[model samples]
Target chain A: MAADISIGKAPHPLAVLPFYGTGAGFFAALAVLLFMTAGELTGHHFNPHVLAIVHTAALGWGTMVIFGAAYQLLPVICERDLYSVALAVVSYVLLTIGTILLVWSFWVFEVGALMITGGSLVVVAALLYTVNTCATAALHQNSSVQRAFIVSSALWLLITVIIGLLLAINLRVTFIPRNHLDMLKLHAHAGLVGWFLQLITGVSTKLVPMFLLGKSKREWLLYAALVLQNVGLVLFLADGYFNPITAKMLIYAGIVALGTAAWLVYLADAYRNRLRRKVELLMKHTAVSFACLAVGFVLLPMAYYFTDTRWVSLYGTFLFLGWITAIILGKTFKTLPFIVWSSHYRHLTGKVKVPLPKQLYSERLTVYQFYLYLAAFVLLVAGMIADYMPLIRVALVLWMMLAAVYAANVAKIIFHKPMITDGNRTQ
Target chain B: MEIELNSPFAAELVKAQTALMQVIDPELYVNIVDLGLVYGVDFTNEAKVKVTMTLSTPGCPMGDAITGGVKNALETVFPGREIEVNIVWEPRWNYHMITDEGKAQMGLE
Candidate 1:
């Protein structure tokens, strides 16, 4: 089959820009908060302040970018416009307010009305996003593997949020019979593997090949990944409820490992066949991300087997900051430049000499940012394992610098002024 | 597959196509003609040239940029001549419409 080069329209950049900007702001703030509270967070992941920090990073920074990118990407892949731009705006507003309120409530350890209201708003926001994505996907003429990945991932997002809300309510009501810690583990896994990883896998399968100018051949690998991931998630959730610290938990861990390995293999094949001989700096970060995913998967089972809080923290760090955050950073650098260039310089094509999409940003700055990010990530994992406050604080500083560099690069692209090479007027 | 070098219209067509190579679909990193976006070119008796084209998707946000690029390219080649660009959705563009050169460039060969 020939490659689908159809140029589908994207939602206006304005529709998605707020999410990226706000998410970056929250990420920068989280880095600072991490530095200030490094002493308090040492070996205590479940404290209210720590919870606030985690949620701010996960929901405000990570999921926020996913929401925005989805709106911009889904339409192009599906060959349809967004079903409801108005709904997307509403979702963004609700998500922003909800994330702020939830973080504040956790910071003050107020598990009362404030927490309930914030949690509810987030749930509603997730529901709205799900509706919008599903409606858009429904318009596609044929069923595709990409569609399966995206639609199922959206469903997982809904489930993850709903379970989260239940856990929040249970904290006050004492409705669940199981241990709160075990339930919390379930909630975290559901969000990380089911919602985040699943969605990332889906989007990357299509995008990686296009970026490399390579053909995507293996459909079965994607299907297998989808099946294994969902099955593993369901099993893990069951294990969390039934046997939180038993050998049976290994079943889910093994399944997740297989799924992750399958995805890695598929991606590796695509890269091997790529026509683009030179691997860009962004792709170098992506390769590191894959390695991080493998490390995290390996550590997950060991963490459970050892039953050590330090090991658990290390696993979370590798998965979240190393794998997910690295991929997001890499993709952001690649995607944002094209978006900015198309919005600004596309009109000048043929009429006047214009810069290529890749020329819109500074690659050197991006490379430096990636190095800082990797260093900080390593220090974070080491600090968590050793419970070293100073190391954690230093890592936080490095992370803040990385975020700042990223923001600066994005800013330059957005505000770029084209230098006209030809002095011809538009007829 | 070769243009008649003696015909003024054919010469203009070649010039227009060559200029159009500069108008790339940024996402695909390929020219619009190779991506099969351009469908027909006509030199009308009223001393005007008309180009018909379609985007990969109906909702393409780059519609204005592409149409503008087409006009700019034709105008540069055939100056002082009226240029008309008609964006039609009919006979939708597909990957199969890619020229042999385009196929080779895209590594499909």
Candidate 2:
């Protein structure tokens, strides 16, 4: 600590903004793709258009925003600085290029060198990310389970991309003995369960309580969640490798489900004890996210039982767009404004007046975006179930508007000029 | 912040504490004075006003802003004096440190 006030460990805004800006751009593009490919949703999800859409959402929208947020979040969780901003930037570039190439290849049904190269670059990027995250965790020897899950998630990301790369290569060579479909299932679950699930659980454990001014005395529940989720995933991958989607897959899924239940229980405890009794819209979005998760959970077995591909598609929609996107929409406002506020107004503080983080963005736009996302998601799911093209197109139209609203708000924050402050503005 | 009756700087300290009411913690939305983050205000150094205080969390992302608010608030009130904010962690801040006004603002009552 400095005798004179130095500062906390916030990374430079530029290091974080590139990913956020690109991710928002990708999401806007994704909305356009959704509108264009509205017909593809009810068919088998392995089609070219579906593959393109999934990659666009997964890599472009989900992973990119996360990479940017992780720079701010990992430091807070680890109580240390990010190991390398340059590595973070490198990974973002690699991910951007790889996603564009890979998604284009999928769209055109080209499964040759370009796709393989794209997948390879993505794998290398994931590896570098894992190295950076692990190095940061190593800086402090804290044994918090949050750290464990965070680091483990990076490892899972590496595994996911490696599997993805191998799958890409196998399209031509067929080197792996296992069935390609089976390997795809393994890769999907690894990324979904291993990477996103664990990462959200870990990060939310810390953030939820802090934001709510809540406390969870149940460390044991977190430990249980950690053990069950990881063990179940390991067994699942092994089963998918050897037996290739056997009946026992249900048992493994059930075990993982139990692990997820543990984390939910912990979050419930925190919510019950929260000092901030009046919940904000952001927290409400979080609740809706879990509700979306429940819908995905219910769809899981139906996706298994019915050979109809729509169930699986619906499951993906609920999990990715419903659960993940909902939370991101809320959390973006939560963290980004604070980050921008700190960067722009830190020096001006204690000398002149300044605005609060919340004042930097439009709350009205966020409310509209939130409602629009929910309506569009529900209508899309309903449209797919009934095979109604008109309804589906309407939903897609709303989604496109929602994406624009979201992007506009993000830009509003990024470009927020320091308006006049009172001689004594504080909060 | 409490003013001791015996202290010679009690009147100046009172004014200083009153001015700090304008500085609120963004997260908590309560004034630091009411939140009990301000430990003491020392006017002994004729040239500078010394503030001893603590944050609700050590790694507060808004640490700079809150401390800077204190500096600005004082500079506005006492333009000639240099403001020195010395953050301490000796007595960690907890819910108990909060005054009734703070608790009311936090909806903890």
Candidate 3:
């Protein structure tokens, strides 16, 4: 079957703007915080300050973008409008307020009323988003694997946030049965694998084909990935809590590795079948992210073996910076231009000459951003493993530069204006 | 410089085409005519302007939105003239159908 290119009625672009804006803000903040606190970060991954920084990057930057992108892409993916625009607005407001307060409370190492309040607000936001997306998915009668992945990922997101809230309260009331660090690991994995990775895989399955003008016949591969990833994540969490056995950990790692391998194969097949001969700049970055994911999966088992904090940090750096952040940076450039273009120039089309979506931003700047991001990602992993604070600081600087360039590009697209003329002008 | 309307049908057709330029393909961010969506326009005896067009895809969810856009554009241009916008699927649109001006705007040239 041909890929679904249904031009559905998306929610107002403004509904998703706050998320993109806040996500960018958090990314910048995380980069700056990392640069300033590099010295204090050595061998302190579990410190409250470090947790604050991680969450700033994870929730503020990563999850924020996912929420906004989901709202924009769901209608196109599912062939149905969003269930409720009002709920989307409410979710955005609550998430913004919640993220700010939670990040603040974490910075001060306060697990008191402030933390509780922030956590509660975030929980509510997650619930609202879950309900909206789930309801939208239910409207589509066909059982698409992509839809299943998306809905299940949303459920995982809810679970991740609920666990987070409990962890926050546990810090104060001491009600949790498991150790704090163990619970933290469970919470992190649930968000990373169950939520972010699953959603990315699902969305990419549809997008890779559409962007490449290719056909994907391997539906079974996608289903296998979904099953392996969720199952592996659950078992991994279980191993963290109850088993703590090396054999069980290895089994979980192997399952996740198989899922990653399947995903890589799917992408490779899509690329091979692509009709578009020239790989665009966005796809270039996407390829780099896939390489990062491959390397991270290889190191996963090793990271489990070595009980060193450095190895663990290296694993996380690869997972977050290499795979997640890289893909986001790449896909943002591809999607954002079209969105801003439609918003600004939809009414002016054919009446007068208008720039194409590609003309809205500088391609040269995007290339530079990709290189800087890749270099920073490598340096970060090396610095973490070696406990070299200076290298990490330099990496942080590079990351900030990447973020700034991206922000500037997006702003250019958002604020673009066309010159009016009687006739259309050729580029 | 103002030009004389040689014929009411000809003048109305020009005005209608100009109005249709205001209706855009929301996803492509280009007007339907430029996007090769408007196949043809016919003026009936009753002064009704009928537009035959197709979407980028058959399953396009913005079908209603673009159809509404066509009606509004025609009404604004010729207030008293009746308007009929018909969506057809024959002779599917391709990138080759884009006009030189549209191609230039899209950087396809």
Candidate 4:
């Protein structure tokens, strides 16, 4: 049957641009914060500046862009219209204000009304996001497993943020009966595994196949992964909160590992059947991201055993700076250019020759950025483990450079103007 | 994929389809015709040209681009003839729809 030509219009560019713009801005800010706090980093994992950087990267850089891309993508993935652009804008405003306030509070090591207010705003934003995404998903056929992943993760994010707010409150009043550090670890895991990992897995399941023009009939694997990962995470959080310190945590980690394996295997099989045989630069970045996931998978259990604060710091670095940042860096070019290109060039398609999405950004800069990032990530991980301050400093400089290059490329996409065309059939 | 030589529209349809070949799927880097997105080329009410098509995937991120390309492609061939694209979901697109030439370009066997 003929579908309506109106087509499910994706989110307006205005609703999304702020997130990507602010996200890039946050990354640049994070790079500067890294250099400024390079000295304080060698100490305990709970240092103020490190906390600030983590929040900035997690909320501002990572979640902000994800929220933006999600608006543009969920419509396509779920094959339905976004429930409300206005709701999305409201969430972005709250998220923006909340993130700035939270990062500032962390920077100054404040645990009073300021931090609590920031945490409360963040909680509301997360709750609003949950409503927006779930309502959007509910508007579509419930059959798409990706919707389940996304909806579940939104719940986890709400939970994660609520726990964070409670933690902020706990910091002032010492009300939480459990150890503060233990609860903190639970909060991080709920966000990381429950929110980030599951959300990434769910989105990628749809995207990888679409981009590759490949089909993998491995729905069972994702189903298994969804069940195992979520179940494992819930158990881990419950045990961590009640029991506090227990060897049984390793068992829960194993369950999560198995779930991660299902996702990895699903992706590998999809790649095997890919019609697009050549893996391009962006896919290579994706490969690097999965590798970071692997490194994280191995380190997850190690974090449980290692009492060394250095291991904890390294864990945070690899998870945030490596796994999250690399994927976003690569996918930003993949998704954002197309979003911008559609905005600029959709009407011009048959009328004239228009640039493909890939041509909108500098390939040379991206290649340099990718290689520089790899080198910096490796050196940073190595430097931290080896207790070498010089290497760490070098890594930080390289990271700042990478951040600058990344911002330049993002700016290039965001501000890409329409090229004049002679209205020739150049396709 | 046969042209009816006896029909008055055969030559014009061939030319129109040939022009449509330039409308490539940006992500797959293959022309829509060879990619098997075009289902038919026919004359509609008042000699208006109609191109029936489907995307490689339903609701593809590139659906609008390729469809816009189709309009421009045909407009150049049949100047001033209004072109309408009717997108259908029937027998939803599968990998086998891709022609051998399309497969070769994508490095598929």
The reply for model 2, stretches above 4 Å from the true place, is A1-7, A420-427, B42-50, B71-85, B107-109
Q: Where does model 1 exceed 4 Å of error?
A: A1-7, A40-42, A242-245, A415-427, B1-8, B28-30, B33-64, B75-109
Model 4 C-alpha lDDT per residue in residues A1-427, reported as the tens digit of each score: 8875334454677768778988999999998898898877756767778889989989999999999988888777767767788888988999999999999999998998999999999999898889989887887654677888999989999999999999999989998999988898899889999989988999899888877767789889999999999989999998888896677887887898899899989999999898777777887888888888888878866776877777778778888988899899888887888778777777777666677878889999999998999999999888989989999999999999999999999899899877744564433
Listed per candidate, the RMSD to the true structure in angstroms reads 4.1, 2.9, 5.5, 2.4
The TM-scores, one per candidate, come to 0.87, 0.93, 0.84, 0.94
Candidate 1: what lDDT? 0.78
Higher-TM-score candidate of 2 and 4: 4
Q: What DockQ score does model 1 reach against the true complex? A: 0.32
* Chain B TM-score (model 1 vs. true structure): 0.84
Clashing pairs in 4: none
Native RMSD of candidate 3 (Å)? 5.5
Cα RMSD of predicted structure 1: 4.1
Candidate 3 local Cα displacement, residue A395, angstroms: 1.7
lDDT of 3 by residue, A6-104 (tens): 435546777676677778888888888778777766554787677778888788888888888888777766767777878988998888888888988
Clashing residue pairs in candidate 3, if any?
none
Worst-scoring 10-residue span by lDDT in model 2 chain A: A1-10
* Cα lDDT tens digits for candidate 2, A241-352: 9886876887888888899999999999998988878888888888888889878878988999999888999999998888888888888888888778878776665455
Distance from true position, residue A48, model 1, in Å?
1.4
Give the per-residue Cα lDDT of candidate 2 at B103: 86
DockQ in order: 0.32, 0.42, 0.15, 0.51
lDDT for each candidate structure? 0.78, 0.85, 0.77, 0.84
